[model samples]
Target: MGEFELIRHYFAAAPCAQGGVGVALGIGDDCALLDLPAGEQLAISTDTLVAGVHFPAVCDPLLLGQRALAVAVSDLAAMGATAIGFTLALTLPQVGAQWLAGFADGLGRMAARCAISLIGGDTTRGPLSITVTVFGRVPTGQALRRSGAQPGDLLCVGGFLGNAAGALPLVLGEREAAADVAGPLLEHYWSPVPQLQLGERLRGLATAALDISDGLLADCGHIAKASGVALQVNLAQVPVSAPLQAFLGREAALHAALTGGDDYVLAFTVPESALTTLAREVHVIGRVLEGQGVTLRDPQGQDITPVQRGYQHFRETP
Candidate 1:
């Protein structure tokens, strides 16, 4: 089928593409227009997922659709911004009606959940890949950033960590487990719920914030570097789900929580005063200190930082 016809039949006709608040002009226009409220700033983020590298070359289009958009929208949540709209640039080897329909359905479901609209994007023939750009808005000077963490702030995460990492073997078909063990882990990997509400509530409270796409330690290093403060991660305090521990064992689960990436949970720093106001789901794992890098502390307060922090796209090989 032709590009225009394909888009119209699949994505353009989806419920998310119908336009919502802040989307002035949606799919048909050359440039999508967004309306921002007075004294608010527009926040945007983009993420690309390649066929083999990011995900299995052959996988469920519905899950891929949900994952692609969720990961990108996590960026907006990190900044404590309210999601507005998104644009998807899809590159496919060939058109398949069934695949498009499933993908569009999943994407539309997630967009509706996040209260975000599908704005505009493009389609082309190529190796399979999906790029989603998300738009959000936050009041001026209120958006959380990575550079504002203070020495006395407490390091925290939105929810349980490492479930997605623990699910890797299951995702790649290398391992199998009971439904009880696999259900939660696989759900986390396939459909991570971005902590948008917690992020919005953290607007003025969180000094520095970001989504943990790259393991906890690596992502926390970013906060440390940006804020010029040391982060002391208490290994004992890091939260891990029961299912993950049951699946991978305590030690392995802890390791995964520390070094495995793609959790998409919000990691941030907030003052002691703000702790009382934080949601119940927030976990306090460490504290910010007047130092240079991230330091991992054992239960007894010994340094035990791992050699491998997290995934990097390109690194020197021995």
Candidate 2:
């Protein structure tokens, strides 16, 4: 099949293609149409995932599809937006029916799960890469921003960290893990769940918020710089999962939680009052303070912001 034929059969016919919230028109059109609700603003973001760079070259196509869309949708979650629809631009070195079937199935399942429709996009010949542009809606003036943190706000994370990072060794074939440890960590890395509902709940509550793509310390620095406030992270307070600790020792687990990237969990700040009002379980890692930049404090009250903060694609050697 040609490009348009492939999209028509695989992507355009995916679940949620017929009707989705705010999507006026979907695929097979010059432009996909979206209708925002009254007093709501559109939130849009784009993310690109290259085969060897983002995932192993021989990774499962299904997981790749899920991860690619989830990564882009994470930005909407940080803005406390409700996902409406998405566009997929897929590039491939060559077409393979089995791979396309798995990829489409994964993408469609996630689109259904998120209640987002496939709008419009392009397919081209190139190295294997997937770029998803997601669109969501937030009430006017209520969208969360990284610049809203206040000095006295409390810092929190949606869930445990380091699982994705922990799975990297196994993914790269550098290490082998027992099934018990491998299953959960591999799931975390391949099929990350975007915190869309939690983000919506935090709209008026969190002072500053962003999904943790980079490590906690590096991403927190973004909030610190954008909000012009200092953030003090208590190293002991960072949430590390038991599985991660079991796979890697406490020290290594701590290292992953602090510096490992691709968690996709929301790291946010809320006022003391809002903290009490939070309905879900969240780890309070630290608090915001007057000043600028992020600092890590140990149990002894000594500053120990590790020399390595997180992953930087350009600066790091793979």
Candidate 3:
């Protein structure tokens, strides 16, 4: 494709809009510019997607584009910062205008939805890889931190879990794509909507918060260690989607939900009084008590026997 065609088709587009993202000149120019607000500092994060590593090689380019940005945005969401701009660095084994078009289309779709913008990026020849760096801003003292959990705080999660793991079998051809069984789970994995608004709202109410990219048990331990408090998660209260239940029976469903990754839902802690207000956007699942570990309670009120260990990037990736 020609330079102008490439620019028009893929480079120039609006990003997701939360506060004022994509309000200024973005990509397709000599230099992208921004009108950053005064007093608020921008939070920045980056993530890379490698073929056969972060995602399957056969995955759709559109979903890859969406996921690449969504994953990076999740980091900003965890920080309670609004969307701003992003730059992409892409490495490709071969040039395919069609593939790039679909990827850009996906990127633009998400950018507009989230009010973000594609500011700048670079291209190189190599194995297929994409690195996206995002910037967001929040008022001073408003950004949430992982190290703020205190004793006696309520633990809550947005939406259900384990759908991705339950749906993995379908994506991998180990099972069929039965909508009744793993449809929503597939959607959760393909196009996870970052909970930016919820994270922003949680800034004051939540003692600590983080999106559940890793499993609940593992991510909760992050907060526990950071805050120096123990977290107790009630298994009965753990929410699972109907589709996930159908794909994996009750026992396995709960286990996968607890130990599965890529939920993108926010797992946060708030004071006891926050239960009522947060009810609109959150589901109370556990509590942070004074201690130094995480405990999962089974149905009979007895602590689960040796909770399954959570996600470890290098050691475990199945």
lDDT on C-alpha atoms for all candidate structures:
0.90, 0.87, 0.78
TM-score of 3: 0.89
Better of 2 and 3 by TM-score: 2
Weakest 10 consecutive residues, lDDT, candidate 2?
Answer: 309-318
Query: What's the candidate order when arranged by decreasing TM-score?
Result: 1, 2, 3
Give per-residue CA lDDT, model 2, range 1-318, as digits (tens). Answer: 665476566767767577577888888879999999899999999999998898888988998888888899999999999999999899988888889889988887777777788898888888998999999999999999999999899999999999899989988989998899899999899888999999999989999999999988888988988898889989899999888999999989988887899999999999989877776678899999998878888889988734564423211211
My TM-score estimates for the predictions, one after another, are: 0.95, 0.94, 0.89
Please give, for residues 137-221, the per-residue lDDT of candidate 3 as tens digits.
8887878888999888899898898877777777677778565666677788878888888877887888898888878888888
Residue pairs that clash (backbone atoms under 3 angstroms), model 2 = none
Whose TM-score is greatest here? 1
- Cα deviation of 93, candidate 1, in Å: 0.3
Q: Across residues 219-303, which tens digit of lDDT does each residue of candidate 1 receive?
A: 8888888898888889899999999999999989988898889999999999999999887989999999997778888899887
**RMSD in Å for all candidates:** 2.8, 3.1, 3.7
lDDT of 1: 0.90
Instruction: Give the winner by lDDT.
Output: 1
